[model samples]
Target: MTKITHFWAFFTFVAFSLGLSNCRTVKNGLDEKIYNG
Candidate 1:
């Protein structure tokens, strides 16, 4: 039970980090296009 809980927590953390990185990349792309346009 404890191991499963730990795995779930780790998965959630990884997913959250990936989502944040994706958002940052999208924002950077938009900024680049706006500035370059």
Candidate 2:
């Protein structure tokens, strides 16, 4: 049970980091479009 719980935490952290990076990329793209237009 403890091992499973630790794995779950690690998985959640990785997923969160990926999500954050994706959001940053999207935000930067939008900013660039606005700047160019």
Candidate 3:
């Protein structure tokens, strides 16, 4: 039970980290285009 809980927490952290990374890149891309153009 303890191992399962640990795995779940790690999985959740990775999932949210990937999502935030993706969102940040997308946001930066739009910001660059808007201000540089």
- Residues 1-37, candidate 1, lDDT per residue (tens digit)? 9999999999999999999999999999999999999
Assess each prediction's global lDDT (C-alpha) against the native: 1.00, 1.00, 1.00
Cα lDDT, model 1, residue 28: 100
Query: What are the per-residue Cα lDDT tens digits for candidate 3 across 1-37?
Result: 9999999999999999999999999999999999999
Rank candidates by TM-score, best first. 1, 2, 3
Best by TM-score: 1
lDDT of 2 by residue, 1-37 (tens): 9999999999999999999999999999999999999
| Colliding pairs, model 2 | none
Q: Which segments of model 2 are wrong by more than 4 Å? A: none
Give the clash count for model 1. 0
Reference-based TM-score of each model: 0.95, 0.90, 0.76
